[model samples]
Target: MKKILSLFLGVSLLCSSCNDVLDVEDISNYNPELVWNDANLANAYMANLYPMFGNWNTGADAFSQQLAGINFYADRITITNGEFKLWNYGRIRLINQAIVDVNKGRLPDAVKANITAQALFMRAYTYFEMVRYHGGVPYITVPQDRYEDDLAVPRNSTAECFDLIIKDVDQAIAGLPKKIATTSADFGKIDANFALAFKAKVLLWKASPQFNPSRPFNNAYWAQAYEANKKAYDDLKAQGYGLVDDYSNVALVERGKESVFTVINSYPNKVANWDNGVRPGSESRGPASAVPTWEFIKEYPMKDGKMFNDPSGKYYKSEEALLQSFWKDRDPRFAKSIVWNGKVYEVSGKAGKRQYTALGVAHELDDFGVNPKAGVNSTNLDRYTGFFILKNSLLKLAQAEVQQYDVDFVVMRFAEVMLNYAEAANETGKMAEALDILKQIRKRAGIEPGADGNYGITANTTAAMRETILAERNVELAFEGHRFWDLRRLRMLDRLDGTTKHGVEAIAVQANGQDMPIGEAREKANRYELVESDFRYSLLQVPRSGVKVNVVPGKYYFFPIQRDILDRNKNLEQNKDWGGSFDPTLP
Candidate 1:
């Protein structure tokens, strides 16, 4: 089967296992031999292929860092030198190689289609991440030959890259199976809703303030974003995808219906860990990345669905009293996302108490023994901060020796689709539609769905709905890796700076066997204090190693291209005015 397919495709096909560079003895001599001869070989190869996505060394482990509070610059621990370029180039090579083999018709039609969809989806995904990080990158779709002139490809325009992503997603949606059959082992193929949701995502980013080239907010882009999001929400809802009845259980249950698409991380099938983004209770929680900021924790509106500063609400008080009252009425997601000190969360041992601390002076978990811990100059207090994220941490796994459990990595969810719809509608002046969607999500969360979803707010004006929807998204999707991009896409990065913010508050627990004093002890006991003046820098400067920075005032739009590539491809020009400069200046 593999042989015939190879002959037909006119090239060899090797799956993840066979193509692994780690196992290759002679890298230059690598070639597909048995890959075409066996069905199991093809299956194994395909299955192993996605490891790169999760390979901390390769793909961003997209979910972990994005969901956690880690920033890209200064908080640059997530990205490394040559890291971004390598993964993009490597994955493109894999997809290009597979496309060459599959086009030969040696494989079964189903196999060909499945592989094509996967390749297309991956290529699109690779480009999506690339654009998000680098603004735009060389759109390399095929494997370059030794003498190929495309090796020194210039960076494509961001608009062009977005167009390519839309095209690829469209093709994948058209060619892929509407649904993968239960008997089919070839799971994870791109589906209708997944592709649609992604299309909406791309459109939303494009329509957002940061990338919305149609400045002053283009009506067409807004409408397009709204239409795409609406279709995705409607389609998914029709397919039985809805919010989890009880919002608290959304992440607690693995792969819930609310999750439209997720990077399936099941135990036994794939023995992987996501602790590097988690906290101390788990083996990988060193460096303490993603520590929830006191500001973020305070964003959840009171459970009564009122702002913390509402003059009429019980939450209005001194910062201390305000937080105490605030914590009581906020959405349930707050507790699920943050691990306050003394709040019993799942830990390694049955009776073991997971003590969250700051500086690790009294807490061992805070000391990861690495440079700067989470990042250079990151507050040493961050090392022993008061809270840890519990949203995706597996409670049951706390008891097992390995603590193996399935933590679904949701790529697209019904709730997000709804939120996207609400955002687009509100942006496009469709206030009624926007209000309906926001209310639906709030209803599921067991909130009154009125503060933002009320008739007065919804019926007043489009701008009114806009703020409500954006705030609703923040509270609902807090810490799910959506904030950074959401802020950027919304073009509200700078705007978010002035908003009330919070971070993990640290208090001395113990030092050399001396218990913390009463004032500090009680302060630590509450675990709901707000951090003062939370916003530092909201945007990052494009590093000079890649391309000269030519960003415009009022926006941080510059992205670096490979300097060497520019040397080779003189035709390529850097972003306007940013080709040669060094200053993390505001856009």
Candidate 2:
């Protein structure tokens, strides 16, 4: 492969002819001097830069999907192919070059600031993605050049990796324009709100069960975790970011109010559009690239702010009753996050008229194949039966499908910051205060708080508090792709691994000549149909075919440079696990 280093490696290499209009001929080849001199070239480059974070083939979108439990397999397991290896190195190359270019001083101050902040945010995000999957990675800051001597660095300690992440994000926050106050071309630059929200994410993950100092139960880490989350909550609030007053609109109409930051998508620039990425029904998110698990659906609590398993409640009657109770008067997010049999989604119907129907855009055969089976999980191969996702998804009621939804795939949202604050407060012994914050989020969602003020949580102890926080995290961020990571980080992957039955009684009733509610029947049909045994192995390990396995517990925390990466640099050392590791207690 040709080694291309355009932006950050050197400023003098950019061609001077590039201008602000999106009209550069021979755009494939990079001549930074020209591109950097023209504000439009700089803007175009920046525009392309942010969406890079949203692509499923790259960035956090890919990582978050894996972490969130929406795996390609039935449960949490991940399958491997050569494309996986290529994906890792390719991302590193693309991001490094973008960062280098933005740092060069040829663009306007505002343009330069926005691009630099975005690049930093992306870089930090990329690092987090790596650590969560492969553990500590070699901290590569500069682009690789023939003359560079530092190509073979070993894995940085997770803590060291986090420190570097903090620095990049801090710089991003300092340089990025304030999102709430900014407008026009600079409308969505990375800012204090985004930076702080991201920091909370990193810190919260680190403070989680899997990454905290303790392997499974690290109570001590709670204080530090809480502090990290609290910082984000306090800072974003000071900056005017908050929950959308109406709960339902938060996921549908007023996404910006709660999102700390996102890759903003628009029409015509459909290349930058997530339209194809998350489309539901027969054509979109339902077709199988990403599928929702029955267990994941079961994780949602009942309307009275209690788990369906609560022994004292009516929700515990049976799987069918439990599922029905879970969605009953609980929260508005249920409608926004889930697609049931009869739920109406906006789509273009056959008559050229827009219509709302439980089935979206009627199922039809296309390139992929048939629609998803009623109980069968969708994959890249299968299409949606009729249901589709509406949250953060753009749809139309016409054949000329134009995407008008502006809700950015908020990489970070203020609502998340608030949850972080509540979780942290609970850990730090500010239980009442934590409960208050939790209540505010619930109130915004039109649900009353739990008796403990944290979603009907009765446990005041730290352990119970943590569990409540995790549950709350799932509901607030469901379908946005937070559950998988939150579970893994909390070391609750095993709990989420097994199959769960939902709406059993409803299924019986449907069979016994009774017309059951759509939600109940859908739950029964979809829930009992799943066989979940693979979630435990979902977090992928680097393939043994590509490199020797050296990842031991402490040493095995990151991906080793591919042997190809090593062939080029004799100075680099591999991560501990790739070459030799025989710890008997692998989780």
The lDDT values for all models are 0.55, 0.51
Please report, as a residue range, the 10-residue window in candidate 1 with the lowest summed lDDT: 535-544
Encode model 1's per-residue lDDT on 1-587: one tens digit a residue: 12222232222233243344313232244354444334454544455456444421111222222222222333121112342333266667767666665666456788777777777877887888877756666777776664544565666777778889889888888877765532344344457677888889888876776665446354467888888998888887787778888766665575567866655655555434544455553344344455554555556666555566666554455456554333455566666666664455545644544444433222444422122222223233323334555666665454343335556556666888888888888788788788788767766666654454452233367766777877787767765656556655655655433222123333333545343553464354345231212101111111212322121223343345455545767755544434543221112
| Model 2 stretches with alpha carbons more than 4 Å out | 1-32, 55-118, 147-150, 180-182, 213-225, 271-291, 314-316, 323-330, 343-390, 393-396, 399-407, 449-455, 496-587
| TM-score, structure 2 vs. true | 0.70
Tens-digit lDDT string for candidate 2 (387-441): 2344544455242352343444556667778877877677668877776776777
